[model samples]
Target chain A: MTKTLAIDCMGGDYGPSVIIPAAISALQQHSDLKIYLVGPQQELQQHLKQSPDFGNRLHIQDACEVIGMSEKPSTALRRKPNSSMRKSLELVRDGHADACVSSGNTGALMALATVLLGTLPGIERPAITAELPNRKGTVTNMLDLGANIDASAEQLTSFAIMGHVFSQLADDVEHPRVALLNIGEEAVKGRDSIKLASDILSNQSQIDYVGYIEANQIYDGNVDVIVCDGFTGNNVLKACEGITRFLYDQLKTEFTSNWWSKAVSAMVWPILRRFQRRINPDQYNGASLLGLREIVIKSHGSADSKATLFAINKAITEIERQVPQAIQDQVAQLLLNTDNEDEE
Target chain B: MTKTLAIDCMGGDYGPSVIIPAAISALQQHSDLKIYLVGPQQELQQHLKQSPDFGNRLHIQDACEVIGMSEKPSTALRRKPNSSMRKSLELVRDGHADACVSSGNTGALMALATVLLGTLPGIERPAITAELPNRKGTVTNMLDLGANIDASAEQLTSFAIMGHVFSQLADDVEHPRVALLNIGEEAVKGRDSIKLASDILSNQSQIDYVGYIEANQIYDGNVDVIVCDGFTGNNVLKACEGITRFLYDQLKTEFTSNWWSKAVSAMVWPILRRFQRRINPDQYNGASLLGLREIVIKSHGSADSKATLFAINKAITEIERQVPQAIQDQVAQLLLNTDNEDEE
Candidate 1:
């Protein structure tokens, strides 16, 4: 089956320089994939490499305006209708592309996507979900990462359902163990919304609810899906990013503190490089906008060409698996039915 | 000045075995510091070593009960009035000890400490504050780590003031830079409460408010104090713990992957050891229960003897610096004065 993705060419720090190479490589890697480069037509065409696959599979949809990285979502939605970010999502919404990938301003993308594509039947809001590399060499999918800051009990339940389906499709886990991200594992811990969500999830026969798991247990790889409010999830994810950078800097300082240590560092550089590759963020760069009617993946704003390729691959995988449809089915079966049962 | 600490000998994973040795070492290190081992008399005495300082400075406070790690705070407060955790706080309240150090159940310890010692003037709830090592080789003091889960704007403002005072005294940063932990650095990014707290903090003449900061910039060493609601702070801290463990395990696996990598890892083991020691949690073990009328330090529940010593030292420092008194003065000068100004 052929998969088509709309690529935002004017997004991210490096813009088309990094994204064009990544799109070219993605096309070369997957013969059945087609990409629509949505940005300024002249600029995007100038960076494109002359390949036999260029006109056949890769096409450019000109977008005149570009959204600033720090622009407000409402302002961007109102003023920048011709932005590469907006055009990319429009491609997916108009059924011209199966999915969209961008490294644009997160808030703007979320607002535009919600307004343009809407959400699944039972999901009132869309969540930004991502995969974190766990200790078991697998990935743990966490959701509501800065999308809905103060989520209610019902919104949290929706997150858990979306995360559950995402893990099954993305990570290929047979029966993904779902858990609430709380401060403690005890039943009485966390805020009232989390406890209420736990109660609602416990009654669901579809989700393999494993109760509450704290942030310290998130990377242990025992649980597959971790659900939390966007406030907590965003803070936790960024804290992990901070700590990773801290350790990397600390290691570099230690290995170059003295002449003898520097020499030893040179000799052991290969092993260190291998270790770096094992936990590199580029290998897992895409954050899927879950609950949206059309698939949209957000690449890290500072991602390089390699990381962008990973993001492109992620969108292809979601398109192949029909993630949005799958989430709709599961949510309709679990949540809407549960609501009806509660009323009865 | 002579500083005395009441150590809960029955707390933490190793209990008396770890606490007794840490107490002995602390006594040997600081000649003027006195300690009271608060626990079962017979069990505490059995773990003691033969030392001349035992009778002169280290005394025993016989508390017959012990609180379980997983016990509810309300249950422990009502049923275990004579618990070692409670006895330690009581010692501080009754002026028998200048401060107290406990590696007990955090929720139980916080409840007992707040009830026995009370909150300082203008402070309604105590927050758990801890130092995280940053890239600049200094520490960033973050607060409200699981004390009040759903903190209000007033509560968050209180946290900023307390954190500012704590950083000045503990980290020795004159006019410490303070920031509210948010998802984005933009003014319109976070929730309404955080926005209100930001407004309150900005108006305070005492606080060196530097506006908002994202969690990814936390370890950059650019800010001295980061304030957030307890739920976000707790999850962020624990997520850092999770990522640290994850990277360490990944590095270990990479180094032992093959004979060549193993030999190289062995060759560079000393540099790696130094790097590990630089970022070791033992160097920074204690989390201060700030905003209390009296000083109390809670050690990590799984801390070994070395880590416990750091917790004891933290309590001694706070006692010497009069942290609670400083916080009281600041809160009075900032919060109370601001309220009066608002009314006028």
Candidate 2:
């Protein structure tokens, strides 16, 4: 199926140079895929000089302004209307693109996307959901990763429903088991909001609500979907990233410490590389801003060309799967069923 | 100075068997330490059979009831008055012991400790603070790890103050740099309560407030103390644990995949083991329940004798340092200073 994506060219660390190539590479990978490279025209054109032509499948959309990584969301929304991030979202909103992929300022991207593309029905706010590589070699989808810091019980329930649909579609996990992220596995554990959300999910007929799971059990892969408020989810994700890097650095230090260790490290380097590739954060670069009216994939700001390609491909996949549409249907059905249960 | 510790022998996974041996080891390590072994008389005696007696140093306090791992905190408080967990705390409450060490149910332990010993002056609730091994080979003390689910701005400021005092006393770091855990380092990022806490912390002349820090910077060791609400802190801590195990397991699987890999792994096993010990959760086992009237160390529920000894030693360190008195003094002074500032 033919799908179009608006690439935020003036986003991330490398900006146009990294994103333009990734978009071009993505276009090559998917023959039916089209991308609107949104950025400052002259700079983007200069960076795109090395890229091979792909006819009308690739085109440039001028966005004079660029959002700084540390730019406040409200400031970005008010001041930077012509930002690459905003332009990318505008493409999706105006039906020029099926989805938007940005490795830009997350706050700016979220704010601009929410303002431009709006949200799906019954979802008060969109959630940022991402796949974390787990023990089972499959991905565990966790949601509300810094979108809404203090999600109410209803919002948490929405996240669970959206996460369930996402896992089913994105990972092709049938009957994806959903669990609430808490300090303890017991029902009595966690804050009142979490407990209320648990109660709401327990009575949920749509999702495979498997009760509360601790953060330690996240990578165990016993459950497919892990739901938490944005604050907890964001902290957990970043902490995992932090520890992964710390351990890897420690391993590298150990391998290079002495002559004997260095020699053995050379022999085991291939095996280690293979293992590293499996757990590489680049593979999981794209985080979907779920429950949005149109799809928006937020790539890591430091993502290289390869990682940006992954994010672009994520947009393609979402477009193909119609993730937003699936979420809308699922949420509507779930809410209707819930209303019926409440009435009964 | 002889310091007395009340050990909840019926706590944790291994219970009396693990706790008794660990207590024995702790006694051997600390010559000036006295222990009150709180548990069932017959079981405690059986576990102590192989241990060489220290005359009048180790006394068994008979508490027949044991708090179940899954027992509700309120239920445990109400029904299990004779529980070993409660008895250990009671020893502290009655001034029989300077500190209490439990590897039992955390919720019950916190509830019982809070109810029996009460909070320190100018403190509403106690926080669970533990040291995480950071990249700099030193530890970062993070607080409110699942003790208080929803901390108010005032409560968070109190946590920062408590954590500051703890780092000074326990970690022996002068002018410890403190930071509020947030999704972003920006002043506008995170929830309102976090922002309010930041505002409160910035004006405080008592401690070195280093502004906001993301969770990914947690292991950088740039910040001495990281303070957050219990929910976020707990999730981050657990997620770090989860990822560490996940990476190690992946490494193990890779190293044991083939004969060549296995042979290489054999040569590198010693190095790997050394690296593992550095990041082992067992080494950082004891989490201090700070802001309480007395010292209480909650060890991991699954901690073996080695880890349990770490917890016991932690209690001894707290007793020697007089952590509670220090926190009480610090909190009182900080409150008085804040009141003076308000008047000004």
> Residue by residue across B225-326, what tens digits does model 1's lDDT show?
999988999899888887888898788787888898888788778887888888887888999999899999999888999999999999888988999988
Question: TM-score of every model?
Answer: 0.96, 0.98
Q: What digit string (tens of lDDT, one per residue) describes model 2 on residues A193-267?
A: 889998887775778899999999999999999999988998899988888888899889999999998988899
TM-score of chain B of 1: 0.96
User: Which residue pairs collide in model 2, if any?
Assistant: none
Docking class of 2: high
Clashes of 2: 0
Clashing pairs in 1: none
Rate residue B58 of model 1 by lDDT: 82
